[model samples]
Target: MTLEAYNLLGWKSETVNLSFPDEDSWRLDAILYEVDSQKSFYWLLFTGGSISIYLLIYFIQKDSLLKAIRKSRLLFTILFPILLIYIDVNRIEELIHLSL
Candidate 1:
Protein backbone atom coordinates (compact mmCIF):
# COMPACT_ATOMS: atom_id res chain seq x y z
CA MET A 1 0.00 0.00 0.00
CA THR A 2 2.79 2.37 0.92
CA LEU A 3 4.70 1.52 -2.14
CA GLU A 4 1.57 2.17 -4.13
CA ALA A 5 1.13 5.49 -2.39
CA TYR A 6 4.69 6.46 -3.04
CA ASN A 7 4.22 5.60 -6.65
CA LEU A 8 0.96 7.52 -6.86
CA LEU A 9 2.58 10.49 -5.17
CA GLY A 10 5.12 10.43 -7.98
CA TRP A 11 7.99 10.07 -5.59
CA LYS A 12 11.07 8.43 -6.93
CA SER A 13 11.32 4.96 -5.53
CA GLU A 14 14.41 3.02 -4.71
CA THR A 15 14.73 -0.46 -6.17
CA VAL A 16 16.60 -1.63 -3.11
CA ASN A 17 14.39 -2.37 -0.12
CA LEU A 18 16.47 -0.85 2.63
CA SER A 19 15.50 -1.96 6.13
CA PHE A 20 15.83 -0.59 9.61
CA PRO A 21 17.65 -2.50 12.27
CA ASP A 22 15.70 -4.17 15.09
CA GLU A 23 15.30 -2.74 18.58
CA ASP A 24 18.49 -4.42 19.69
CA SER A 25 20.27 -2.98 16.72
CA TRP A 26 18.93 0.48 17.41
CA ARG A 27 19.99 0.19 21.04
CA LEU A 28 23.45 -0.77 19.91
CA ASP A 29 23.49 2.25 17.61
CA ALA A 30 22.43 4.39 20.55
CA ILE A 31 25.28 3.05 22.62
CA LEU A 32 27.76 3.92 19.94
CA TYR A 33 26.78 7.63 20.09
CA GLU A 34 26.37 7.86 23.84
CA VAL A 35 27.12 11.21 25.41
CA ASP A 36 27.36 12.40 28.99
CA SER A 37 24.97 15.22 28.14
CA GLN A 38 21.40 14.51 29.24
CA LYS A 39 19.91 15.82 26.02
CA SER A 40 22.03 13.50 23.98
CA PHE A 41 20.98 10.68 26.26
CA TYR A 42 17.30 11.60 25.90
CA TRP A 43 17.53 11.99 22.15
CA LEU A 44 19.34 8.72 21.74
CA LEU A 45 17.03 6.81 24.04
CA PHE A 46 13.87 8.52 22.82
CA THR A 47 14.62 8.13 19.13
CA GLY A 48 15.73 4.55 19.56
CA GLY A 49 12.73 3.77 21.72
CA SER A 50 10.45 5.58 19.29
CA ILE A 51 11.86 3.53 16.44
CA SER A 52 11.25 0.38 18.40
CA ILE A 53 7.69 1.44 19.15
CA TYR A 54 7.18 2.42 15.54
CA LEU A 55 8.30 -1.00 14.39
CA LEU A 56 5.94 -2.66 16.84
CA ILE A 57 3.07 -0.55 15.60
CA TYR A 58 4.07 -1.24 12.02
CA PHE A 59 3.89 -4.99 12.66
CA ILE A 60 0.34 -4.69 13.95
CA GLN A 61 -0.67 -2.60 10.95
CA LYS A 62 0.02 -5.60 8.66
CA ASP A 63 1.37 -3.09 6.20
CA SER A 64 4.84 -3.10 4.80
CA LEU A 65 7.53 -2.34 7.36
CA LEU A 66 8.79 0.45 5.15
CA LYS A 67 5.35 1.98 5.07
CA ALA A 68 5.10 1.92 8.82
CA ILE A 69 8.53 3.44 9.03
CA ARG A 70 7.51 6.21 6.66
CA LYS A 71 4.78 7.18 9.09
CA SER A 72 6.91 6.84 12.22
CA ARG A 73 9.85 8.67 10.73
CA LEU A 74 8.24 11.93 11.74
CA LEU A 75 8.81 11.42 15.43
CA PHE A 76 12.55 11.07 15.04
CA THR A 77 12.86 13.84 12.51
CA ILE A 78 10.86 16.22 14.67
CA LEU A 79 12.71 15.46 17.86
CA PHE A 80 16.26 15.26 16.55
CA PRO A 81 17.09 18.96 16.74
CA ILE A 82 15.37 19.30 20.09
CA LEU A 83 17.50 16.48 21.39
CA LEU A 84 20.62 18.22 20.16
CA ILE A 85 19.66 21.34 22.06
CA TYR A 86 18.94 19.26 25.13
CA ILE A 87 22.42 17.77 25.02
CA ASP A 88 23.96 21.18 24.57
CA VAL A 89 22.16 22.55 27.60
CA ASN A 90 23.22 19.58 29.69
CA ARG A 91 26.79 20.01 28.57
CA ILE A 92 26.68 23.65 29.67
CA GLU A 93 25.32 22.68 33.06
CA GLU A 94 28.07 20.16 33.53
CA LEU A 95 30.67 22.75 32.63
CA ILE A 96 29.19 25.21 35.10
CA HIS A 97 29.14 22.64 37.87
CA LEU A 98 32.75 21.79 37.25
CA SER A 99 33.71 25.46 37.40
CA LEU A 100 31.91 26.05 40.70
Candidate 2:
Protein backbone atom coordinates (compact mmCIF):
# COMPACT_ATOMS: atom_id res chain seq x y z
CA MET A 1 0.00 0.00 0.00
CA THR A 2 2.79 2.45 0.88
CA LEU A 3 4.75 1.62 -2.24
CA GLU A 4 1.68 2.08 -4.35
CA ALA A 5 0.96 5.42 -2.76
CA TYR A 6 4.48 6.64 -3.50
CA ASN A 7 4.37 5.35 -7.03
CA LEU A 8 1.09 7.09 -7.72
CA LEU A 9 2.53 10.32 -6.35
CA GLY A 10 5.61 10.02 -8.58
CA TRP A 11 7.83 9.72 -5.52
CA LYS A 12 10.71 7.35 -4.88
CA SER A 13 10.65 5.66 -1.52
CA GLU A 14 12.48 2.77 0.12
CA THR A 15 11.11 1.49 3.37
CA VAL A 16 13.11 -0.14 6.13
CA ASN A 17 11.31 -2.60 8.37
CA LEU A 18 13.43 -2.65 11.46
CA SER A 19 11.87 -3.38 14.84
CA PHE A 20 11.78 -0.09 16.75
CA PRO A 21 14.25 -1.35 19.34
CA ASP A 22 13.08 -1.66 22.95
CA GLU A 23 11.03 1.48 23.15
CA ASP A 24 7.47 1.97 24.23
CA SER A 25 6.58 5.56 23.41
CA TRP A 26 5.27 4.92 19.92
CA ARG A 27 3.04 2.05 20.95
CA LEU A 28 1.36 4.09 23.61
CA ASP A 29 1.07 6.88 21.09
CA ALA A 30 -0.83 4.68 18.70
CA ILE A 31 -3.38 4.07 21.43
CA LEU A 32 -3.32 7.60 22.77
CA TYR A 33 -3.91 9.40 19.47
CA GLU A 34 -5.89 6.70 17.68
CA VAL A 35 -3.89 7.35 14.54
CA ASP A 36 -4.84 5.64 11.34
CA SER A 37 -1.75 4.14 9.73
CA GLN A 38 -3.31 4.25 6.29
CA LYS A 39 -2.02 7.80 5.83
CA SER A 40 0.63 8.45 8.48
CA PHE A 41 2.94 6.79 11.04
CA TYR A 42 2.90 9.22 13.94
CA TRP A 43 6.32 10.89 13.49
CA LEU A 44 8.24 11.31 16.82
CA LEU A 45 11.73 12.76 16.39
CA PHE A 46 13.32 13.56 19.69
CA THR A 47 17.04 14.47 19.89
CA GLY A 48 18.36 12.54 22.86
CA GLY A 49 18.34 9.05 24.40
CA SER A 50 21.06 6.46 24.07
CA ILE A 51 19.62 3.09 24.96
CA SER A 52 15.99 3.18 23.86
CA ILE A 53 13.66 4.55 21.20
CA TYR A 54 10.32 6.32 21.55
CA LEU A 55 7.51 7.33 19.20
CA LEU A 56 5.00 10.16 19.30
CA ILE A 57 2.33 11.42 16.92
CA TYR A 58 -0.88 13.37 17.51
CA PHE A 59 -3.20 12.54 14.63
CA ILE A 60 -5.86 10.02 13.60
CA GLN A 61 -7.59 11.22 10.45
CA LYS A 62 -6.33 10.12 7.08
CA ASP A 63 -3.87 12.63 5.56
CA SER A 64 -3.56 14.44 8.87
CA LEU A 65 0.16 13.78 8.75
CA LEU A 66 0.62 15.87 5.65
CA LYS A 67 -1.68 18.47 7.12
CA ALA A 68 0.51 18.77 10.21
CA ILE A 69 3.59 19.32 8.12
CA ARG A 70 1.82 21.80 5.91
CA LYS A 71 1.02 23.84 9.00
CA SER A 72 4.14 23.41 11.16
CA ARG A 73 6.97 22.17 8.94
CA LEU A 74 9.02 22.08 12.13
CA LEU A 75 11.82 19.55 12.47
CA PHE A 76 9.39 17.78 14.77
CA THR A 77 6.93 16.87 11.99
CA ILE A 78 8.61 15.01 9.10
CA LEU A 79 10.80 11.85 9.41
CA PHE A 80 10.66 12.63 13.11
CA PRO A 81 7.81 10.10 13.80
CA ILE A 82 7.88 7.24 11.17
CA LEU A 83 6.24 9.84 8.93
CA LEU A 84 6.87 7.13 12.09
CA ILE A 85 9.89 9.41 13.96
CA TYR A 86 12.38 10.98 16.54
CA ILE A 87 15.10 13.63 16.01
CA ASP A 88 18.40 12.98 14.19
CA VAL A 89 17.66 10.12 11.86
CA ASN A 90 21.33 9.26 12.23
CA ARG A 91 21.36 8.87 16.03
CA ILE A 92 17.88 7.52 16.64
CA GLU A 93 19.13 6.11 19.94
CA GLU A 94 19.77 9.53 21.40
CA LEU A 95 16.58 11.08 22.69
CA ILE A 96 13.96 10.99 25.40
CA HIS A 97 12.39 7.62 24.71
CA LEU A 98 9.34 6.02 26.29
CA SER A 99 9.40 2.40 27.32
CA LEU A 100 7.22 -0.03 29.28
Candidate 3:
Protein backbone atom coordinates (compact mmCIF):
# COMPACT_ATOMS: atom_id res chain seq x y z
CA MET A 1 0.00 0.00 0.00
CA THR A 2 0.90 3.24 -1.31
CA LEU A 3 -0.86 6.51 -0.70
CA GLU A 4 -2.92 6.10 -3.86
CA ALA A 5 -3.94 2.61 -2.86
CA TYR A 6 -4.86 3.90 0.59
CA ASN A 7 -6.99 6.60 -1.01
CA LEU A 8 -8.69 4.05 -3.22
CA LEU A 9 -9.44 1.91 -0.18
CA GLY A 10 -10.97 4.97 1.55
CA TRP A 11 -8.45 4.98 4.39
CA LYS A 12 -8.76 8.57 5.48
CA SER A 13 -5.80 8.71 7.82
CA GLU A 14 -3.33 11.55 8.45
CA THR A 15 -0.84 10.17 5.91
CA VAL A 16 -3.62 9.92 3.36
CA ASN A 17 -4.74 13.45 4.17
CA LEU A 18 -1.69 14.93 2.43
CA SER A 19 -2.28 13.77 -1.11
CA PHE A 20 -0.28 15.02 -4.08
CA PRO A 21 -0.91 14.65 -7.77
CA ASP A 22 1.72 11.92 -7.81
CA GLU A 23 4.31 10.13 -5.66
CA ASP A 24 7.33 11.65 -7.34
CA SER A 25 6.14 15.18 -6.68
CA TRP A 26 5.32 14.36 -3.07
CA ARG A 27 8.82 12.91 -2.54
CA LEU A 28 10.47 15.85 -4.25
CA ASP A 29 8.52 18.27 -2.09
CA ALA A 30 9.57 16.37 1.00
CA ILE A 31 13.27 16.42 0.07
CA LEU A 32 13.20 20.10 -0.92
CA TYR A 33 11.54 21.08 2.30
CA GLU A 34 13.93 19.09 4.44
CA VAL A 35 17.09 20.13 2.56
CA ASP A 36 16.51 23.83 3.27
CA SER A 37 17.22 23.40 6.96
CA GLN A 38 20.54 23.71 8.83
CA LYS A 39 19.99 20.46 10.68
CA SER A 40 21.21 17.46 8.68
CA PHE A 41 20.01 15.36 11.61
CA TYR A 42 16.41 15.97 10.53
CA TRP A 43 17.34 14.91 7.02
CA LEU A 44 18.93 11.72 8.36
CA LEU A 45 15.85 11.00 10.47
CA PHE A 46 13.50 11.50 7.52
CA THR A 47 15.68 9.40 5.24
CA GLY A 48 15.96 6.66 7.85
CA GLY A 49 12.19 6.62 8.36
CA SER A 50 11.53 6.27 4.63
CA ILE A 51 14.13 3.52 4.37
CA SER A 52 12.53 1.71 7.31
CA ILE A 53 9.22 1.58 5.43
CA TYR A 54 10.91 0.16 2.35
CA LEU A 55 12.82 -2.30 4.54
CA LEU A 56 9.51 -3.46 6.02
CA ILE A 57 8.14 -4.04 2.53
CA TYR A 58 11.29 -5.91 1.55
CA PHE A 59 11.04 -8.19 4.58
CA ILE A 60 7.36 -8.88 3.88
CA GLN A 61 8.03 -9.83 0.26
CA LYS A 62 10.74 -12.37 1.25
CA ASP A 63 12.58 -13.02 -2.01
CA SER A 64 16.30 -12.39 -1.41
CA LEU A 65 15.47 -10.17 1.54
CA LEU A 66 19.02 -9.69 2.84
CA LYS A 67 20.33 -8.63 -0.55
CA ALA A 68 17.51 -6.16 -1.03
CA ILE A 69 18.14 -4.51 2.34
CA ARG A 70 21.90 -4.38 1.77
CA LYS A 71 21.37 -2.64 -1.54
CA SER A 72 18.89 -0.28 0.06
CA ARG A 73 21.32 0.61 2.86
CA LEU A 74 24.20 1.09 0.46
CA LEU A 75 22.21 3.50 -1.67
CA PHE A 76 20.57 5.19 1.29
CA THR A 77 23.77 5.92 3.22
CA ILE A 78 26.14 6.57 0.32
CA LEU A 79 24.09 8.21 -2.41
CA PHE A 80 21.05 9.74 -0.77
CA PRO A 81 22.80 11.89 1.85
CA ILE A 82 25.50 12.96 -0.60
CA LEU A 83 22.92 14.10 -3.12
CA LEU A 84 20.89 15.88 -0.46
CA ILE A 85 23.89 17.75 0.91
CA TYR A 86 25.16 18.65 -2.55
CA ILE A 87 21.82 20.09 -3.62
CA ASP A 88 21.23 21.90 -0.34
CA VAL A 89 24.70 23.42 -0.29
CA ASN A 90 24.41 24.58 -3.88
CA ARG A 91 21.06 26.13 -3.13
CA ILE A 92 22.46 27.95 -0.11
CA GLU A 93 25.46 29.16 -2.09
CA GLU A 94 23.18 30.53 -4.79
CA LEU A 95 21.17 32.46 -2.23
CA ILE A 96 24.30 33.84 -0.61
CA HIS A 97 25.74 34.98 -3.90
CA LEU A 98 22.49 36.57 -5.08
CA SER A 99 22.82 40.30 -5.75
CA LEU A 100 20.20 42.71 -4.53
Give the per-residue lDDT of model 1 (tens digit) for 10-66: 797543222334643543334224434544655676677666686759664887767
Q: After superposition, how far is residue 14 of candidate 1 from its true place, in Å?
A: 47
lDDT by residue (4-55, candidate 2, tens digit) is 1135376856542333344654644443343233224422233321112222
Weakest 10 consecutive residues of candidate 2 by summed lDDT: 48-57
Candidate 3 residue 23 C-alpha distance from true site, Å: 36
| Candidate 3 lDDT by residue in tens digits, 19-53 | 33453464445544544563674477567758766
The candidate with the higher TM-score, 1 or 3, is: 3
For model 3 the local lDDT of residue 44 reads: 79
Of candidate 3, the 10-residue stretch with the lowest lDDT total is 1-10
Q: Which candidate is the best by lDDT?
A: 3
Against the true structure, whose TM-score is highest? 3
Task: Score candidate 2 by lDDT.
Answer: 0.35
Backbone collisions counted per model: 1, 20, 0
Stronger candidate by lDDT (2 vs 3): 3
- For each candidate, what is the lDDT? 0.52, 0.35, 0.54
Q: Estimate the TM-score of every prediction.
A: 0.30, 0.20, 0.34
